[model samples]
Target: MPLTAQQLQAWSRQEAAAAQQVTTATQASIWLTLWAAFTGWYSRPQVSDLAARSVRILQPARQQTGGLGAAYVREVLAGLDAVREKAPAINLPAARLGADLEQVYSRPAEAYRLTYALTEDTAAATTAAQERLFTLVRDDLTVARRDGEMLQMRASGVTHYRRIVHPELSATGVCGLCLAAADRLYSVAELLPIHDRCKCTVAPDSDTADEAVSIDLDQLYEDAGGTDGAALKRVRYQVNEHGELGPVLGVEGQKFQRQGDAPKGDPIARARRELAALEPVLDSLESRAAAGEDVAGPLAYQRDRVAKLRAITA
Candidate 1:
């Protein structure tokens, strides 16, 4: 007999398999990195090269940058371990959403019973959830690395960290959130990434912080007072957590904040939320374009805008 929608939704076999993959894979990768860091540090000369020793012992810092730190390795490991525990919690909501969707679509469209995209959408959403879960894990690990390595620097008399975002195609010619704040040097613990997916590398900054610099500008502009003459290099539209384009009034040290009802933390999550909010408009625009209307130009422009917004997280 064919199972009813309720019966199908109640099935856990698929969910179990998917969840297990996300959980185990994340844990394995983290441990593997830790093992490599341990081996590298352990194999190095144990003499007075405390800085070199800190890199391997702290681990993630070595993975992020060839940097070192001390006294915080145990805490950082515990923090990274917590990412595994967070996986199931993240998966649960995705499971419920998938189940509800399957229930609705695994039924008859007319008198004759039918089934359609329900199963596929459910699976796709679950996979998306798993990918996002991994993103969170990576973000947490980045923050942990910064924390641990900062301790090592503090102990070794290293003073500052210069935030450097590894440039990629999407981020070309743009300063990400952390890099925006790199106008002046920061204390070892200070120059960490402001938010998730912010893989800005913080190397030991030799330049002193709070120093004055001079520059010549050809045009008059908003003169936000700072000793360093760090003027706006370029202007890119700022999108908040809700994915709405709003005023960024952004200076080097000021972090971006979402206005309106957008959920806080993780700009990418906000952008996703914004995209979801725009579905009706997107569908309409797409429909118009398909019907051979003039929406192609507008649709393309809107899509390009949204794509840039989405890439903020990337």
Candidate 2:
């Protein structure tokens, strides 16, 4: 069925909103089809460009979103070019459906399953992709830890061990740790691959060792929650008590041990110190939110802190 102009406009707005929410080019392409369907204005050139870019980013298997095969992308591009020359106002439903099908097939019903299988099982397609990428890097990588017992380096240059263990159910912990380290070490735009069973860990260069230090656990913990203290607590409880470690920790029973003996200070005193450091950040965030300033900037800091705090308290 040919979509009315009004319908097409509505779909375009929805697709734009979806695109804004996507964190990856692959995701954007998949969602863009929805926009095309709603708007009925599938500019072939734009769609072709988007498809090519998205295919380059996503895993090859994900390129087939709907039951449509990889050739569907080429077909869409060809159709778009033909329409540009002959039909200014053409039927877009079939093309839109093809694009949507590609998106559906490309997306994993369970993203965690796909990420985990790729990272854990060596034969998996995801693992192959990661290994292929690793072969391209030339940096000398090493494991850095505060205590020898806290982290262990595997015989395989690709794996590391932490004493504090969590299950790999979701990519949250793994992604959080990697992203935090990456943010400090490289620009945000730099691609950092993090996945379950990924062995990659970053440490300061030999010359930077004297200046390198573990991130402030308290500040990192507090910043995780921002103003949502209750939600933070719930997440902490889930990770610590409920055994819902998600994908960050990898497997259950893998623990990240503390490098040093427990601090001499009282527990209450430590809590007070942690809270003191966090209050200012939270206060700043609250003020910004109240003033209608973009709250996301502070919110990320708050969330990181909350994660750190949970690690400490747990």
The numbered model that scores best in TM-score is: 1
Query: How displaced is residue 131 in candidate 1, in Å?
Result: 2.7
Worst 10 residues of 2 by lDDT: 138-147
Cα lDDT of model 1 by residue, 1-314, tens digit: 33222222122122223323433455455334432232111112321242233223324322332122222222222232332111111111121112232222111111010010112132343344334334434433444445445555555456665543332212232243433454546665443534444433333442211111111121112132231225344432232332211112244344555445455677788767666555455567678778988645445545765577667746
Candidate 1 steric clashes: 3
Q: Residue 278 deviation, candidate 1, in Å?
A: 16
Compose the digit string of candidate 2's lDDT tens values, residues 1-314.
Answer: 33232332233233223322322333344345432232111233443454344345443312122212112212222332332211121111232113343343222212212332223231353333333222211110100111111111111121222111111212332224332333334222222233333333222112221122223222323434333434332332011111111123222343433325465657656655665566565666667678988656334545565456656665
Candidate 2, residue 238: Cα displacement in angstroms equals 17
Off by over 4 Å in 2: 1-22, 34-201, 207-213, 216-218, 226-248, 254-314
